[model samples]
Target: MLFQIEDIITKMQDDKTGGVPIRTVKSFLSKIPSVVTGTDIVQWLMKNLSIEDPVEAIHLGSLIAAQGYIFPISDHVLTMKDDGTFYRFQAPYFWPSNCWEPENTDYAIYLCKRTMQNKARLELADYEAENLARLQRAFARKWEFIFMQAEAQVKIDRKKDKTERKILDSQERAFWDVHRPVPGCVNTTEMDIRKCRRLKNPQRVKKSVYGVTEESQSQSPVHIPSQPIRKTTKEDIRKQITFLNAQIDRHCLKMSKVAESLIAYTEQYVEYDPLITPAEPSNPWISDDVTLWDTEMSKEPSQQRVKRWGFSFDEVLKDQVGRDQFLRFLESEFSSENLRFWLAVQDLKKQPLQDVAKRVEEIWQEFLAPGAPSAINLDSHSYEITSQNVKDGGRYTFEDAQEHIYKLMKSDSYARFLRSNAYQDLLLAKKKRGPHAYTHTSCLRACVKKAQSQVNQQDDKCLELHLRKGDQGEYQPCVCLGIQGWSKSSKGKSLAGKRLTGLMQSS
Candidate 1:
């Protein structure tokens, strides 16, 4: 039996192409003056659409009412009521206070009108935002299902690659083969539609019409039948994989387009409103406070500070340490006199081989994790240890700085080398100009004491050589006698220097 109107289970409203694309009611409201009362909006919907159905009008009105006209989406117009529950608008600019005004609850209903146009325009905008979001969601779900199907197919392909172990596998295959003619009605229909490529075969595109051909003129118009597009095949899978590899081409294109469109919208919109500046927001529709800033300054390694005082909804990372970390790490790098030098110098590598921090991280995970390689056999890996490598000098990535750290912490010779990179600059300055370069008598003694011990353990005469290269840059080498060398060499330096000599001669 053919279906009639009474027999129809799904109407256009209920057809669920995901959801109906209703533009944000708030925007439409904004275009008009004010329509706080339900009746006014309901009337507008009726006059606007020539909608005959009372229920449909009521539904559309409810959509507007729910939005409460503050946000760009939904009924952002705040429908203030004395007693009402608070809920967030699915879009921007809406606050619960709009609907639930703090002191104004005496009236059963009150509509706020910043301006008459603000009310109408907001309703229309809300309508547009809602509809576009719904359209995007419907499309997004389609993409998601496609992705899931692709993932499942990959898993199936992986299973097919494994060898069958049982002796009766052929018998099992025969049984599966006999039943494999079917994939249920829905899946079979999908499978058929997929096989039909309008591009490859002309029959697939046969008189593309929304419904049955107009030639078959009849009383009722059939709803459009959309044939599903076919997915890529095994050959196409290779191309898809290649496409996935070029992520910048696919993902970035959409993102780049969106960014360009947004910029164009801003640039064009600025002429309409001169307040628009690259520095600050000019659009009344958009909020400047939409984005938050990290105002909290927590830690100061410069001074001792404690943990966990300030991560809040309005702002997070408040402690001095948190704010200072980025600055201090950038400023006070010990390796180079200035941090900008490393930043200003360009390296052609995607991530340079010479970037000690990155290389060390790779070497740490790749080479050292398996246990420090026997020094004799370590050269087989592709990561070459080149002399060009520079000290990372970045404190932020200290934990991630793989081998540079491992060599510092591990090898006896390297411990001295690690301890030594600091001293050679001062010492080099010293031998060239006699000894006035010393700034800290106390800290220098402690450093030299540590270096002396590390050098003494190994016998290459450990002559306190300056600058040997490896995972890190050539260190400013200085000697120490620790459980290996002497502590006094750095502290009581020259007993009395030429400054004292001059004083003695004067006396």
Candidate 2:
């Protein structure tokens, strides 16, 4: 496709009389999907080996425009005679003339045919032939008109007048012969074509007065050749099959060489040896050291409990199963209304202002009102204020209700939640079977076994806790929040032991 366009452009620029008309070039380009503009044609040409010099490229571009292959049009302006205002307007088309005929279309078609013969592959040859056929058809449609135009141009060239050369002699004669002429005055006809200071198409005598010939008026019309359609034969089909088979064989040989090279390349660079290591490989089950839970184990029980539940708010929101279990626990205690209201208020806050009022009314009717379907325990005064607020609800009208619900859950429902069996079971299950737990439990077993073997090296001042065997036959270590001064006093040791025992039993 690219070579075909370059061929057309080369033929066009090589024309001595500028180049083909703009519409003829456009019509040729319309057959190909790739060529769009004169610049596209030039840039494609510049990449070719033949168009190496910058001067040739510059010359080709100049010919494309100067030869009427591309014509530029400007905006038309209108002005008000009364005022100084002017208006610029655009027309649908800017084409001032219709000259679609090309002077050397036969040479362009010959270039395309020569390009097809240069290609080695049958498919490419057929493609170029089809493109040439299309161009031929385009020419055939306007052949009669093009022939007439060429004939007209030929006649015009043949009848070139010497009026400009005779201007001085005609003017002198008219000056001496015209009636009532001022000195050196010449009639309009006496002036040459260059200096004709007369109205355009001035009145003239009939053709008989000038002795014009009847043969020129009765000249024969041009005859255009008819395009023929060729039918396919069996020999042509067999020839195409032979070409395709040869192409396939050539492609297969190239692919075989490529595959052999790839195999040799891989064998040269790739390592295929077995993996060998020095130590008993560290357990793959052990995890990286980042933990969401607070791992600073020495804090007081009350403080630890606060951190766990505070962090659990995000956990519950993130973990769908945990949230569902929490909601179920709230349902068991008949306080699910608090969670429901909180969730609805969260959704309401995200809604548009127009939607918030409707959502506020729904929440009040469904959960906040006295004897409502899932009524929450609100005081009578709070209930009345909330109902009135819902009636006059703006975007933030639900704020007070959401806050009241949040406080109720954190103080009453959330406190009970921590003590619920569902909450304790979640912690136990996560500590035992979770991915992090699998690694954590493995680490603890290793640490405990190592501690037992090096009992003599164990610091006596440190609080020592007992080790217990888990269901998987791995010894789990009792992790103590390293409390200072506890192992020094008997009372402190007793209290620490009790707290450590409770923590182990709870987990």
Candidate 3:
């Protein structure tokens, strides 16, 4: 559609009759060159396309302008209006039909060149200024190169005639307007969602009986007669039926295996799932408590949490306590280099682009170099790949080696770590604490009693309160006399009872 409209626009730019009047429009202080009025464009569209409605012609003109065949002289918006607003035809080289997909570097250079120019007409817009700043940060390492190219282009542009320069600048701006339209404007260069999906996962092309592709067949100059369709025979039908039965059987077997795997995984992790199995100390979000989070952050791991480490190597590494235990186990086995190498590779991925080369070299020297102090084993294929990658000095220089070591540790070292005494000791310690040892009520009671003892040591006459189990299995307040004699007045007893109740509730 864009190509078809551009062709019509090309004909409309002709100097002969039927073309829109192209002239210089003199404003207050400046002359706009090679421009046509929006009214003239709409009238030409209505006359040449034989459209009876003026509204339809204006609509068509707006579509053409949005596609960047032409643009208004003084607006960032690319829309046609039925008025005397001046518009210019974009240069043929800048037309969307040319398939110009400018990269960020090109845009950055153009914006940089605009900054160097002193003319107000070439000044960057607010959004363009923001884009330039972002591009500078993104391409920081090569910004010097981009600036040099922009300078060279600016020098060349300076030698062009004043009128030609104005036209060229407007054309370039319109080209970018189509590619990176204003925030509210429709971006004409954006592909349809369906087209993007088709590009990502295209269907296989059909091939002819001669093994030529359908596209090639259509483009071929030689004429070929179509072959008659062959009739299906009973033997072919039987073969197809047998093949389909086999496929069904295989599919059923695959589904059954998948179902079993899912069931096993659920059973293994059911205890760890807070929703299915109630969390110890209650869920924080539901109960308005942070006990569960506090327990996880503590140095000691719970028995259930430690047990989850056996489920997967990733599970073990994800838990800080479990990871520390595994590291100790590896150190005892003198194979800690594998874990260290894997950690270094992970960190390398996060390094900035300018620092990647330095980090990559350091990682290679420490992990993969021959006779290195803490070298780990790697297969010949991975070692060779790592060697080549190290020469390139990229962030993933040891990706293959890291992956190999990870699988080795997960299959061998991780299994042994689960059975090691260090991990079993942690699980046993947590198990001995049991569910009753650290109940919330017991901890609160202990804190209240400790406060009571501190007060008694300071003032021996201070009242004390004790919490006792009630009939409903909840804590009830009970007054305990201090070292002083009890008051005999009814008012004194009532005040003491109220104080006891307050202490119990606060605890």
**Candidate 3's residue-wise lDDT over 1-507, tens digit each?**
776897789779876857998999887998888999999999898898899899998999999999998899889899999999999998877776555545666677778888888888888899997788677767656776777878888788889998999898888888888878888899987777677556632222222321222322231122112222355578767856676666566634578899999999999988778779877768777775576787777787767888788788999878777778888899999999888888888889778768999998888778778878898899999999889767768655676788899999999999888788888888887665444223366566784565455431334466554554433364444445543222234354444445444544553
What TM-score goes with each of the models?
Answer: 0.18, 0.28, 0.44
lDDT-based ranking: 3, 2, 1
Clashes of each: 65, 2, 0
Q: Which candidate has the highest lDDT of all?
A: 3
- Comparing 2 with 3 on TM-score, the higher-scoring candidate is 3
Looking at candidate 2, what is the lDDT of residue 134? 52
Task: Using lDDT as the measure, name the better of candidate 2 and candidate 3.
Answer: 3
Candidate 1 residue spans exceeding 4 A from truth? 1-38, 43-305, 308-507
Pitting candidate 1 against candidate 3, the one with the higher lDDT is 3
- Residues 1-507, candidate 2: write the lDDT tens digits: 323434455454443644422221223423211112434434444664368765676466544333222222110111111121111111112111221111224322232324333223212233334544454445544433434543553344346544321222222212212211223433212336454334333232112111223222211122111111345578767856676666566634578899998887565434321133321113233534333233224221222222244344544544445456668989998878778877777787678646877887888788876568987776666667667667767444556566777777777777677788877766665455322222355577676554455333334356654454455554545444442112323354544444544565665
Worst 10 residues of 2 by lDDT: 73-82
Better of 1 and 2 by TM-score: 2
Query: TM-score of model 2 relative to the true fold?
Result: 0.28
